[model samples]
Target: VESISVKKIETVEEFKDLKIQKSEKGRGISLTLPPDIAICEECLKDLRYKNKKKYYMYPFVACAVCGPRYTTVNALPYDRERSTMIEFPLCNEDKTSCVKEYKDFNNRRFHAQTFACAVCGPQYQLYDRSKNIIETNSIKEILEITARRINSGEIAAVKGMGGVHLICLAEDDKVLEELRNRKKERKYKPFAIMTPKLAILENLVIFSEKERELLTSFRRPIVILGKKKGSNDGILSNQVAPGLSSIGVMLPYAGIHYLLFDFIGQKSLIYTSGNVSNLPMGIRNEMIFEQLKGLADFFLLHNRTIFQRCDDSVLRVHNDKVKLIRRSRGYVPEYLPLPFEVEISGALATGPELNVTGAVLRRNRVFPTQHIGHIKSLETFNFLKNALFNIKNLLQIEDKEIEFIACDLHPSFYTTTYAKELAEKYGINYFPIQHHFAHVLGLM
Candidate 1:
C-alpha cells in the first residue's frame, strides 16, 4: 500500500497553514462520495431528550457522518451550496444556535452541510386525497395522525429521503389484498415491510447474524430473510410475500420513520416504492400526487426537495455474506475499484433495460448510478440519462475524455439506443457487449 506522511497540528494557526494542492489536468483522486447514512444512536437519543431543545423531535437531525449524500446532491465538490439542503438555511440566532454548533469542533454536527433544527429545516405535512393539507399542531401530531390512519387500514404515500413510499398495514389480509389490487403492477411480488425494531422482525423472519447486521447497519438496506414457520398465520398476512418463503424487511432508518413508529401499534408496516404500472418512483410533490392518484388515500410529505430519485436498497445474506438485489439509496455514488488499471481513460456503460443501473468508469474505479428501474418508458429512460449525467458531473469527467460507451447487444433496447446517442453526441466509440457476457464480466 502507498502511504503518505502524516502530521498533527497542535493549534488553529498550524491547521490554517495547511493548503490543498490541485490535481494534474484530466487526472484527479478522491474518496468515493458516501451514501445516505442512517440516523445515528446519538441523534436518535437527541430526538426525545429534553435538554436537546433544538433537536428534540426534529425530523431532519443530521451530522457530517450521517444523513443524505447522493440523493440530495444536485452538483458536487460535495458542499451545502450544491445540495438540496441549501433551501433550508440556518435558523436565526434567536430560534437556534446552529452556526455555533457548526463552528464548534467538539460538537457532532460541526461543519455538517445538512445541519438544521426544527425551526429552519424541512417539515412534514399530511395531505388528503384532494391535496388539501390536514392542519396539525406539529410534526409529532402529523406522525400520530398518519399512523392512526394507516392503522385503520388506509394507505398513505410517505415521502422519505430519496422518493415516495406507498405504506400500509402489513398484518391485515384485506388491506394487503386491496393494496395489491390498487397497485396493479405489483400484484403478486413480495412487498418489503419496515419494522420499528429488530426484535419485532426476529419474531417474524429467521435471519442470521450477518442479516441482522445488515438490517441495523448505517446503510439500513432491506434484508430478505426466510419466514419462520407460523409467521404467515396471523402476525403478517400471507399476501405480504405471496407464496414466497422469504420476506424482505428493514428497520427504521430516518427520524420520521423512528418517530412514526412511536405512534404505530403494529410491529411492522408495508413500505414499498411509490410507483404504478412499471413507471419510475415519484420524487417531486406535484408529480407524486398526480402519479399516485387513487392509489394513496393520503400523503405524508415533506417540504424538502429530493434532488435525486433513489429507491430503498434491497439485499439478502447467504452463507454469512451479503448479496445485493437492488443497490440504491444508502449505497450509491461510491466507486467500485478494479484490481487492474483500465486501458481506457474513461468509459460509460448503460446496463440492460430491466432493473438497470448505469456506470461510469475512470481509470480503475467504476461509479454506478442508483437503481434506475425499467428503461422501457421515456420517463424512466430520462431518469437513467440524468443519473449518468449527475455521476459524470460529480466526477468532473468531461465528454472529451469518455473514450467509449458500452451497452447490451440488443439493438432495440432503449439503453442501447441511448448509448449510441451518447456516443454520437460525444464523438466516442460505442461497444455492444453481449447481455449474459456482461453478467459474467461483473463476476470478474
Candidate 2:
C-alpha cells in the first residue's frame, strides 16, 4: 500500500483546531500536447534533398514538424488512430510504424502525427463533373487540365485542405461573370484569391513591411490587401469586391496547390468555396456529385477522407494588430495552459459563434479543429455532430469518463443544444459558458 501524508494547520475562530491533510505521490508524467507546428526548417531541408530516401517530389513526405493538424484529426488526444492516417496504415518497410514511436525516433518524421509516405498515405484522383474518372496517377495532370479549362474560361471545383474550392481564371471577365451567373451569388461579399506566393502578390498589390511579414507568417492566413495604384483594374472582376476597397488573398499552403501554381505559372487565381450559395462545401463523393454537379465543370478530387470540414481562416492587420476574422485552418487549436490541473483527461470544446470546434488537453494538449462553418442546416449540423463524436472516440475516451460538458450561453445555438443532450445522456455536469467570456479566457 502507498503511504499517505497528513499536515496539520492553524486558524482563527471556530475552525482554529481544524486540520487538513493531503496525500502526495508520483501521479505520472504529464503530457503537454501542442497544436501541430509548421514544417520546420530541418524537415524542409530533407524534402529538398535529392539523394535522401525521402526527398523532393514526394508529395506526402511530412514529419512531426509540419503537416495536417485539425483538418485530418478525427478527435482529441490526437493519436494516429483518431486521425485520417488511420485510413492509410503504416508501411511495414519503415521500422517506425506508429506515430508516437516515429516521433520518438531521431528522424524527420518525428512527432508528425499525419506523417506518411506516398506508399501508405492519402492519394488523389481527378474526375469530371459527371462523376466520370478522368485521371488518377499524377495530381499534376489534373492541375494541367484544370488550368487549361480555367484559361479557356471555365470554373473548376478544386478540392483543397479542408474543403472544395470553386476556382476560375481571375483575369478572365467572361469566366467570372459566368460563375457569378451560375451560382447567382449577389456581389455583396468579397472572394479570396489564391496566389502562388508572396513574391507574386507583391507584384499585384502593394504590401507594407508589416503586411508582408503577416502574409508570410507560418499561419499563412488570407490577408486583405488594398489594390495597387495604376494596376490593371481589369485583372479581376469589379464584382469580386463589391464594396470593399481591398481584396482577400492567400498563398498556396499544400504541395498539390504549389504544383497547380507551377503548372499554371499565373500570378493569382480566384478561389472560393466549391458549393452552391449558402450551402457548406461538399465533402463526400455523393455530396459533391449531388450538390455541385451543376456548379462545377470538373472536379479535382482525391481519395483521402476529410474527418472534419474547415474553411480558410481570414485575418487582417488592423491598427497595428492582427485581428482574426474567420478562425479556421492555420490559426486553430489555440494553445493555452489550463488554469488548474484536474484529471489527466481530454475534452472537446465546441466553440460558439458560427461553427468553431476545438479539442482540449488530449494527453495534456489541446488542438482546436479548424473553423467548421455555420451549423445552421441539417447537413452542416450533422457534420458537426459527426466531427465531435469522431474526435471524442479518436482520443480513446470512454463515454463515462467525461466529467464536464461545455457549451455556449446562446440558447439558439445548435452546438449548445447538442452539448446539453450529450450531458444528459452521459449524466455529466454541463457548464454553459458565455461566448464573449470564453473568448476573453482564450485570449488570456
- Tell me how candidate 2 scores on lDDT: 0.67
Clashes of each: 0, 8
Candidate 2 per-residue lDDT, tens place, 103-146, comes to 45455554556777655676666778789998546545656776
Report how far residue 16 has shifted in candidate 1, in Å.
Answer: 11
Q: Give me the displacement of residue 75 in model 2, in angstroms.
A: 5.2
Summarize candidate 1's per-residue lDDT along 1-444 as a digit string, tens digits. Answer: 135798986765534332334323343644345788898998899888878788888888888788888888776556778789899888758624887777666777767888788877898889998899999997778888988898999999999999999998899988888988998878899999998898888789998777878889999999998999999777899899988999999998998888878888646899999998768888999989998877999999999999889999999887787788999988897778899976666789998989999999888988899999888788998899899888888788888989999999999998998889989999888999999998898898
lDDT (0 to 1) per candidate? 0.86, 0.67
TM-score of 2: 0.75
Residue 287, candidate 2: C-alpha displacement in angstroms? 2.4
